[model samples]
Target: MRVFATLLRRDLAMLLPGGRRGQSLLPFLFFLAIAMLYPFAVGPDADLLRRTGGGVIWVAALLASILPLDRLVAPDIEQGVFDQLAIRGIADEAAIAIRVLAHWLSFAPLLMVAALPASVLLNLDGSTLSIVVLGLLAGTPGLAAIGVTIAALTAGLRGGTALAGLLLVPLATPILIFGAGSLARPDDGGILLAAAISLVALAIAPFAGGAAIRAARDS
Candidate 1:
């Protein structure tokens, strides 16, 4: 229990904005940049902006989400943190699960909050804004898990950041579809589906990341 707490705290500190390595503003800024520039590029069509805004937000969120993956696992591995954790009898699975939680905490809430301003910028109405927020809440955890897993797998490779981003895009596509799709639909089914996918990703990430870390260690 103590070990888990310690690790979780450390991970949060490292990944949270203004922490040692957290690119908290970078992703947030990138997300805002997309939103800010979008209206200019497409011209002032209020109806068009409202209609397509949710999807644009989803795209921005997805791209911004990947920006931090490069630092996810590689830094810890380089600093021998994982090796030390293993030596102390901590399971890699447990470590990774904690990281997933930390990773999600670091950005998910901010992304949700950022959505409010984005909604204003994009001219999204109340109901559509609600759908966007709900969808992001349901999907961001899955995105975080995928980021961690990809980061772990590509920790020591050259161009690993680019590879991780490329790998993440495909895996995150379903979440994007379901999450953003809900904005266009009348029901909550898409959000439910996105939540289900998030649960699956959350369930699988620890094992997948653990295995990748083990492989990296052995190689």
Candidate 2:
């Protein structure tokens, strides 16, 4: 627990130079603005807005998540923190898990908060909003996990973000399917299935990411 807290603090410090200036908040704000603008760009009809809301919000969330992936592992690798941690007897698996958690802490909440205003703009109903929030709560961890692994794998590469996307988007298909599906059938078993898939992804991501990071470090 203490190790996690310490690492979390270290990550936060790295991410935010000054606590007063929230760094990742800008991306979230941009996500909100862009999501809100979609309806206006499409049309003002409430029915049209409602029909498109789920996809628009989900796409926006996915895009917003992409913005943070480069920051996940590059800085640590560049500054030798990753190597230091590797030398400190922390297992690569555990270290990657901690890093993913830290990434989630910084990025997922920003997406959730940003989603709220976009939800209103999209005309999400009570049930749909709850499902969206729940899906995000469940799914973003998976995104962060895969994202951390991809980030680690491409840590030193130029244009890593684009590479990461290519590697990650296919992996993220399940997440997008279930997450968006949850919105379509909030009352059905689909939401539960989405949540289940998320948990499974969460379980799978750490080990996958850890192995990738370990391999990257070795090579």
Candidate 3:
């Protein structure tokens, strides 16, 4: 437990905004930029923006999640951080699980809060805004899992960063669908489904990332 806490703190220090590696802000800013700019791109159509805003926010969140992918696992692998952990009896899976939690913390909460102003910008009603915040809360964990897994898998390949971005979109579609789809019909259990999907993704990510790390270590 202490080891996990230690790792979590380390990962947060690396991944958090203005951390040593200087991440966190890109995704936050990117998410905000999308919300800020969407109105202009579509012109002053309040009704249309309100109607479509939830989905746009979902898409923006997913895309913004991608911005930090390359930094998630690659830096550790490169610096032999995982190797040091291995020496101390930490399994790659356990390490990855910690990272997944840290990764979610890096940006999800801020985006949820940002969704407030975004809601106002898009003219979202109270109900829709509530649903959007709820969906993001339920779904961003899955996005975080997907991001870390991709980062681990593509850790050493050439052009891995771009590939990571490309791979995330398709893999994250289920979360996006159910999460954003909830806005259309909030009481239809879409949030529950999104949460379930996130749980599944979260379950899979640690093992997948562990194996990918093992592979990277061998090659």
Off by over 4 Å in 3: 186-188
Task: Give the candidates in order of TM-score, highest first.
Answer: 1, 3, 2
Best by TM-score: 1
Q: lDDT-based ranking, best first? A: 1, 3, 2
Please, what is the TM-score per model? Answer: 0.98, 0.89, 0.98
Over the stretch 1-219, how does candidate 3's per-residue lDDT look in tens digits? 888888999999998899888967889889989998999999889899989988999999999999999889998999999999988999999999999999999989989988898888888899998999999999999999999999999999999999999999999999999999998883859999999999999999999999999999988
Clashing pairs in 2: none
Report clash pairs, candidate 1: none
What is the C-alpha lDDT profile of model 1 across 1-219, one tens digit per residue?
999999999999989999889567788888989999999999989999999999999999999999999888998899899999999999999999999999898888888899999999999999999899999999999999999999999999999999999999999999999999998788999999999999999999999999999998998
Task: Return the top candidate by lDDT.
Answer: 1
User: Backbone collision count in every prediction?
Assistant: 0, 0, 0
Residue pairs clashing in model 3 are none
- Quote the positional error of residue 61 for candidate 2 in Å: 0.8
